[model samples]
Target: MEMVYANRMTMQTIKSSTQDQNPPTSPGDQHSDSGVVKDTMAKRSTLSETVNQLQTNYSSLKAERDELLTNYSSLKAERDELLTNYSSLKAERDELLRQLGSKVEICEDLFALQIFISMFHNFWIGLTDSNEEGTWKWVNGTTLTT
Candidate 1:
């Protein structure tokens, strides 16, 4: 008797589980279920598209950043080169100025020499008397003894 009772209880449980699995469905319920599935799929596809777009934008930005870095490096190299050239030119200019100063000093000395020569020439001319060879007289009216 216990075995029979247990079998009957088992059979009743199986029947209830089957009924729960296949709950009575209406035609309208089937349409609503399909609609929910379609909406969920649409949302998933939209989210996937957004993610793809973001990934593409990220790649493009990364490439641009790399390009900018390369350009910056090139410009830095050029700037260093320019600085080196500027230093060299500055040294050359300083040397040239030193040479020019020396030349100016030489020119001033030459001008002084020319002025002295002119003064000496004028003094010799004034000290000479054209009267006789032995009558050489100074401009102050002093006669030469020799």
Candidate 2:
């Protein structure tokens, strides 16, 4: 009889241990789990939207960067063309200056060098003699008196 009672006590202790390991969930625990699931879902949705917005912003910035690079390339080409033109103009101006050393000026014989130099605009005198030969005029609409 004592052995049978000991066996019954052991079985009850084993059942209690099993119940402790796998506890039954109450209504409050179920509600809490549902709330956690809802919270996790909300967080996931927010994160997805944030990622999409970031991707859109990245695309916009990339487009802007591409446009700026294109503009830079165009400006660089224009600058190169301008530099080439400047070099050509400088060479022509120097050649004209050398030729002027041999050519007699209309007013240089009568006026002082300073007086003739004062009439020059930026030290450049453009004669409009190409259109009509023997009829010369300054670019600023001053007719040659000689």
Candidate 3:
């Protein structure tokens, strides 16, 4: 094992043993398991930009849905219109909604993936002290046998 990792494990052992005598000071640090580091402001700005883009897309999609609804109602009112026209228009509207549904699902999946990756990276931050830092342990309370 690397000296750094070994030292960190030793500190963790000492800290855990002494927890009853002294309470931990802080919850944990913000460093993540990911090798990449991000500045707080840059992360915030990226999130803000993503949110703004999503809002714009939502508004656009909403307007399109509303327009389809208006057309459907107006077509329904025209009782003389051929059944084929109504059916075709309804199909188009359904297709639009289905496409939008898939897009939303994709976005949701991507967001969940991002959150999972972040959580996975940071999960070990709390179990060890700073002196023996950069060591990763399984997040579950059980100690590893190996």
Candidate 4:
């Protein structure tokens, strides 16, 4: 039986005892005083039971609260660690992008130099003449075309 139901039943019994009171109590009627004493003892026992249940409930709740605190702290630490790792990875990605951009600039410079070399070589070929027909050659005796 639930504690609340048991308590209510006990309360009803006490009320009945009170309602059946004797109108005039003679000193010889030791029964009336004994009845009152028994009712009081029953109330005290019920109250004691209620108090013990409340204490037990409190202890259970307190332990649950401690477990929640432990879980919260662990989760907080994990979140911090994840944030740190994310920030570091972001920084590393930015660094890699910066390096790639620098390399692209260097490659562009080298490409421009190669284009200039080809243009100068063409100019020299234009300025020079073919010693014989159908033979295109450079000043360095390298054959320019077939």
Candidate 5:
């Protein structure tokens, strides 16, 4: 019957496939296969160690980046605070100068004074306005006329 023939053919095919999976090998082939397996295992171990080392390095770098970012934020905050304080001091100085009605005077006299002070440590000035602003006076308390 056809059923009996089909069953016989299936059994033969199964046996053939099984033989292919576990074919008889020479001693040489066995030794070569063993060597290939050992080599593959060694390569796998090296690759695994490399991957672990890379992961550790990546973690350290990430931590360093985070620390640097934190420091940058702190520095930025300090700079902003300093700027705010500087602005406040500048405003206060302007207000005080305004209240005193004393404006900063820039003229050749200032430059001359700087040169004279650099040249000498202690000296009496020939002309000054210490008694009153814009009213030049001599050290003998005599007012200078233009």
Candidate 6:
């Protein structure tokens, strides 16, 4: 009888130890899992918000770039027009200068011809502004301004 009682006590202790080691899942564990899920959802929401903001900024920048491109094209057209006008004016001026040179050569009076040539030379010098170097200036007297 004594050995049997000892065996029964040992079995009861083993059962209690196993029950303590493997407890049943409780509502608390469920709440902990829910907290983790909430954290993951929040992180995803933040990432999605950042992505949306970046998309908006990209669209805004694209619009600005398009506007700048349009303005650049307009300015380029204007510059081309100005260059054409300048070329036309230069051609007309050259023709006028050639005609004036031929007329000056045909003058009969030597004194009058000399006076006319001197006046023409003075006018040419004044137009070119040889004394002032026009608008071009150099930092070290090398004159690189164009």
* lDDT ranking of the models: 5, 2, 1, 4, 6, 3
Write down the RMSD of all candidates, one decimal each.
Answer: 23.8, 11.6, 39.4, 23.0, 13.9, 12.1
Clashing pairs in 2: none
Badly placed stretches (over 4 Å) of model 4 are 1-29, 102-146
Question: Between candidates 2 and 3, which one is better according to lDDT?
Answer: 2
**Span of ten consecutive residues with least summed lDDT in model 6:** 122-131
Worst 10 residues of 5 by lDDT: 101-110
Candidate 2, 7-35: lDDT as tens digits: 88899887877746435477545454777
Per-model TM-score, in order, reads 0.49, 0.51, 0.30, 0.48, 0.50, 0.52
Q: Tens-digit lDDT track for model 1 on 30-137?
A: 554777887899999999999999999999999999999999999999999999999999788778979865221122355776776765543233357677776889
Please count the clashing residue pairs in each candidate, in the order shown. 0, 0, 1, 0, 0, 0
**How accurate locally, in lDDT, is each candidate?**
0.73, 0.77, 0.63, 0.72, 0.80, 0.70
Best by TM-score: 6
lDDT of 3 at 75: 82
- In model 1, the worst 10-residue window by lDDT is 101-110
Q: Candidate 4 on 20-137: residue-level lDDT in tens?
A: 5555465545565776887899999999999999999999999999999999999999999999999999788778979865221122255775776765543222324468676766
- Write the residue-wise lDDT of candidate 6 on 11-124 in tens digits: 988787774543447764545467688789999999999999999999999999999999999999999999999999978877897887633134446687688787675432
Model 2 residue 130 lDDT score: 71
Model 2 regions lying over 4 Å from their true place: 1-31, 102-146
lDDT of 2 at 36: 85
Candidate 5 stretches greater than 4 Å from native: 1-29, 104-146
- Of the candidates shown, which would achieve the greatest lDDT relative to the real structure? 5
Residue by residue across 9-31, what tens digits does model 3's lDDT show? 89889877774644444444333
* Model 1 stretches astray by more than 4 angstroms: 1-32, 102-146
